[model samples]
Target: MTESSLFKRTAAELAEAVAAGEVSAVEVTGAHLDRIAAVDDAETGVHAFLHVNREQALAAAGEVDAKRAAGEQLGPLAGVPLALKDVITTADMPTTAGSKILEGWQPPYDATITRRMREAGIIILGKTNMDEFAMGSSTENSAFGPTRNPWDLDRIPGGSGGGSSAALASFQAPLAIGTDTGGSIRQPAAVTGTVGVKPTYGGVSRYGLIACASSLDQAGPCARTVLDAALLHSVIGGYDPLDATSIQQPVPDVVAAARRGADGDLSGMRIGVVKELGGEGYQAGVERRFGEAVEVLGKLGAEVVEVSCPHFDYALPAYYLILPSEVSSNLARFDAMRYGLRVGDDGSRSAEEVMNATRGAGFGAEAKRRIILGTYALSSGYYDAYYGQAQKVRTLVTRDFEAAFEQVDVLVSPTTPTTAFPIGEKVDDPLAMYKNDLCTIPSNLAGNASASFPCGLAEEDGMPVGLHVMAPVLADDRLYRIGAALEQALVSEWGGPLLDKVPELETA
Candidate 1:
């Protein structure tokens, strides 16, 4: 295949071809690297990566080729090029969460997913950028600087996982890793016109991922197609003894479900349209496109019904409270004396002075904002009123999802209220910006499987609109099945990925 053809194929398609001996792993890796060289330096500079493992990737691809020659057993991802969000630890590369504090710090070990991806023989592309500590909905909060949107360079690529989404959308890489606490993974995918799946919280092990909002943070897949996402998800999901919350059982066969969906079916699924998320704050085109997605599922012989989730109204405030509190606790590990950036005089400085200088210099404004908010919420008399009450609200939100799931197999909504906005649009107004995640935070709090795939393009802005699909916790494979089915249906009508038809940008 030509290098551009290699860039354009979905991760699964590339993997399948490689596994079938139609192509060698080295050629594919080379093509991807060439594509990254061609565009990653330019105007739609996705900045998807914080570090590029050029030598490591080439070495891995070479080994894959040698293994096949030796007639060794091979995994499906044997030749695939993929990225790890910098938050996921990798012994060979730095694992900064887009923060200056940990800028050049490499972990001594790999995360469960990072290890598994390596075992599956996927080539390591690099570490992608993200919001500092995965805190914001836009990568503008990243210490490495914002990842620009590929569709329109002036706009955002989405946050927390913006770099991952932008990487795949721009064909810099066919697949990448992302951690979603609130809407980080899916929202970025929605805006970038890619597929991102936030597997049921704890579906993927969190032992080595940097903590964000601990209860809500989930490392998931971002790719060009639903089946590609399924391929990566299936490989990464399952138990890890090191992660306390990991489910003890093997991950259900998510890949098989995607294969089943690709067979052109969705017979008896009960897909619920959440009544509360459809109107008001949502943009006209978002709701319009979601309505069309419902229609697609209906045509595929699935029952789609509107279900009410009244408790969702309280999800946003509760999330901000809970996330900050966890962050305050998790970030304490970054104190200057222990690890990361250390500031102040080595011998003369007091412990408190060192910490203050380190944190003040290392942390971005958003990180500081959340840490301050968290510290205050957890302090003295205010603890009972803020953090405690937010926990109660979290419990209520979980119950809300349970109630809705009882009536429907999977819940659906427009992924975000709108398409990608200008890069700096929401960064200045913290509260107004956090509201961007209003539709997304509830599912994260509930510890469920959520997926965002392009439903259609927006009429007003000609940007991609995403439809959110969710399933109960641990029923993750079902999400892949339904998501793949819907993806196939939508593609049948719209032809191919929304970005394919849009004009490509001139490089810087």
Candidate 2:
């Protein structure tokens, strides 16, 4: 382990070193803060973080060191620093969700996951940026400006969760928390050469997550390696009474599965390749890398076969309708009458007028577009024609997943159709932007566990390509098992992690 560049180490390694008294938590935290200050320049930096809680982070790290000094038993991830997606609320930090509506708003209470992280002694570094209300495929929708892909500064980092991915890729943080609603987590991971998971919908509580689409939204761990992600997943996932939708069951033993696979064996695992997610529209390089990944799985002793999920073709259209409908409702709480930004509130103005003004000023174009589309879809007679039909389609997609799961333990596909596109390339093209989620949305509709891990870099643009693996609702361990196995194989083949090939950025 190289102590000089602590930022390059994995979360698990950092935790181990800290727990062994090889290094103090405050030292680790301060080193990361210093790195952030050096590289996260306003003009050339990745701009992954929206806020950096230097004071609080250092204090938390010091507390961990004190606890260890007192001979207290610390958790597995104790002293490992993490970046929180702005979509998750925090009592100590501001959560904007990349929207002006909630800018500078700090909640009085911590989210369930936030509390869990604290209990595990994981220092919350600060909030990373995201799409406005978690609505867009790219972080371009963020009012805070976009996060640049570390692979290529001119390109996108992937969205709603791009900041988290970007932060990991740039070595600003070893771990991050991301919310996946129509691929916010996985898509970013796919493009940035990192690992991201979208656990079963209720696997992690949504109590403090700002709603995007209630039924589709899920929070999961993002890290550089499968085992690190699994470690973070165990720390954050479990039942929460505050979240009515939270699963009242034991969290999967992802850490054990990851360790098993790290030994590089997947002999009895049955992996399915989804028929509908590939071909025509997918970039050739993405397909090539995905094909190589499948071959690696076969050599690792896993059975790989193609399975059709016909209804997956309709996932995007259905998701667009259902998500906007939910967004219209969930985002309604941002009216000027409550917390956050308020506009046109002079005595002469009516509350309704003030609300209209506030919303008009606070929302970005993409958000307004979705709100209008959602409002129209849920309108009197059209509800049955659009929103109602979309729900039926959602059921069909779920059924497709259920049917496919019976034939295989896990399913595989390219996490995204292509690698990261240049920033501003699709900002004005809504359809092109929406297409990015085609490979990732079905799992959200089905409420299953899905993850993206670096397969290899696409030859065309030299950007990362992710191999997506999905498993049934409580079978999250399956994702880590395969991911860890594949990662080990790829690492052995390449002589290092995929991010090792990334071009070095000139940090300040």
Candidate 2 steric clashes: 0
* Tens-digit lDDT string for candidate 2 (16-40): 9999999989988988887788777
lDDT tens per residue, model 1, 1-508: 7877987888878888887788899899998887777667633466778888888898999999889888988887789999778899999999999999999998989998889999999999898888898888888888877888888888888888888888888888898999999999999999888889999888899989999878889999888887888889988888999999998887878888888987667778888898888677788988898898889888888888889998899999988889999999999888987678998857998999998899999999999999999999999999999999999998998998999999999989899998999988889899878877887888899998898988888889988888888889888888788878888877777776676865574554
| Candidate 2: Cα lDDT at 173 | 90
> lDDT score, residue 7, model 1?
77
Task: Please give the TM-score that candidate 2 achieves against the real structure.
Answer: 0.99
Q: Please, what is the TM-score per model?
A: 0.98, 0.99
- lDDT of candidate 1 vs native? 0.87
Against the reference, the lDDT scores of all candidates come to 0.87, 0.93
lDDT, residue 28, model 1: 93
- Please name the candidate that would achieve the greatest lDDT relative to the true structure: 2
- Show the colliding residue pairs in model 2: none
